[model samples]
Target: MSQETEPEPSPGPKQENGPTTTGSFLCLHTSPPLHIALHGMSALTHTRLSRTAFDLCLELLEAGVKPQALADIVVHILEFKEQFN
Candidate 1:
């Protein structure tokens, strides 16, 4: 008699490091400019602001923002925001 094979484990849902959908939506409406500014500053400053942005992004992600959407919004805001220009 042949031995029975075991079933493979199913994969779990994917998890993101930052910005949940709800958080991103709130962030988009509440302070899109500020969000974009921070993301920009983080890139320019390359130190404190960057870390802060990363932390905030993580918080937003945990709250529910999609990574791609959050990144797009951040880039859009950063490009147009006067301070960065």
Candidate 2:
């Protein structure tokens, strides 16, 4: 069954690190979500994927849903986001 999620604490959409087309920024804030997601990506790829993946990872982390495995689910979610949209 589908469930509605609680709202996120992050800032609104207008505060993007870059333009929507560019999709992300170069500055590293050292947030937990970014720390994990940026683990293996190259500089170029990280800047590109960070926009979408960072938000998703932040949402998951805020929900108190820690995974016992490694970065597996994070990778899967990234792939899904890329594949579907």
Instruction: Tell me, by TM-score, which candidate is best.
Output: 1
Q: For residues 1-85, could you state the per-residue lDDT of candidate 2 as single tens digits?
A: 9999998898757765531221233233445455545654534465344656655654454445464442577677668888988
CA lDDT scores, all candidates in order: 0.64, 0.53
**Candidate 1 clashing pairs, residues 3+ apart or interchain:** 18-61, 19-60, 19-61, 19-65, 20-60, 20-61, 20-64, 20-65, 21-64, 21-65
Give residue 44's lDDT in candidate 1 (0 to 100): 87
List residue ranges in candidate 2 displaced over 4 A: 1-48, 67-70, 77-85
| The candidate that achieves the highest lDDT relative to the unseen native structure | 1
Per-residue error for 82 in candidate 2, Å, reads: 9.2
Q: Write down the worst ten-residue block by lDDT for model 1.
A: 20-29
Error of 2 at 4 (Å): 56
Give per-model TM-scores.
0.37, 0.29
RMSD of each: 10.4, 17.0
Q: Write the per-residue lDDT of candidate 1 for residues 1-85, one digit (tens) a residue.
A: 9999999988889876444356335444345575678667767865433456686775676577787897887777666774665
